[model samples]
Target: MTAPVLEIALLQVRPGQTPAFEAAFAQAQSLIAGMPGYVRHDLQRCLEDDHRYALLVWWETLEAHTVGFRGSPQYQEWRALLHHFYDPFPTVEHFVDVTPGRLPPS
Candidate 1:
């Protein structure tokens, strides 16, 4: 298994708040994309469950996110854009992409 290297944040917006959620999320994405060691982030909306959204984030390491990104000025923007959309704090989990196929061909 690879070292635990990815931080996953799963978010669920309040019902009927998708538009507001997206507006904030877009602003955050713009800010976070510019940070060092911030590799990628993608957002998904649920068709079956309208209030559900998924935020998939990849970074060089967990420290790059929790320490570097959150510690930077850019994090304020990230917070402003995303914090209110959540009905509650997000469920955060960390795991490595350890599947033989989950990792890039090497």
Candidate 2:
């Protein structure tokens, strides 16, 4: 069995485009949810910055996101719907469970 991985991205919506971007993301999230090995995800808006967001996606493995999702055609649609809203574009990173005994932090 493979340990779960967390895919994190800091999303910075273009000025005045937060609402539009959020609407698009609402439609695009399903594409990620339906993929193989997908666990769950959360999209959170920064209280300090309304135009900034954090996307935290949990997958069964890194490849489940980097290979399965990004390599699929659905990703194209996902990109089309949400990519343009980004300002400098977000940097996505992957992380693994670190705590040895307790449940991972939410």
Q: What local distance difference test score does each model get?
A: 0.78, 0.93
With a 3 Å backbone cut-off (N, CA, C), the pairs that clash in candidate 2 are: none
Clashing pairs counted in every model: 0, 0
Q: What TM value does model 2 have?
A: 0.93
Residue-wise C-alpha lDDT for candidate 1, range 44-70, written one tens digit per residue: 887888888778877877888889988
TM-score of each: 0.84, 0.93
TM-score winner among the candidates? Answer: 2
Which residue runs does candidate 2 get wrong by more than 4 Å?
103-106
Error of 2 at 100 (Å): 4.2
Instruction: In angstroms, give how far residue 98 of model 1 lies from its true place.
Output: 0.9
Candidate 2 per-residue lDDT, tens place, 46-106, comes to 9999999999999998889999999999999999999999988899999987777966545
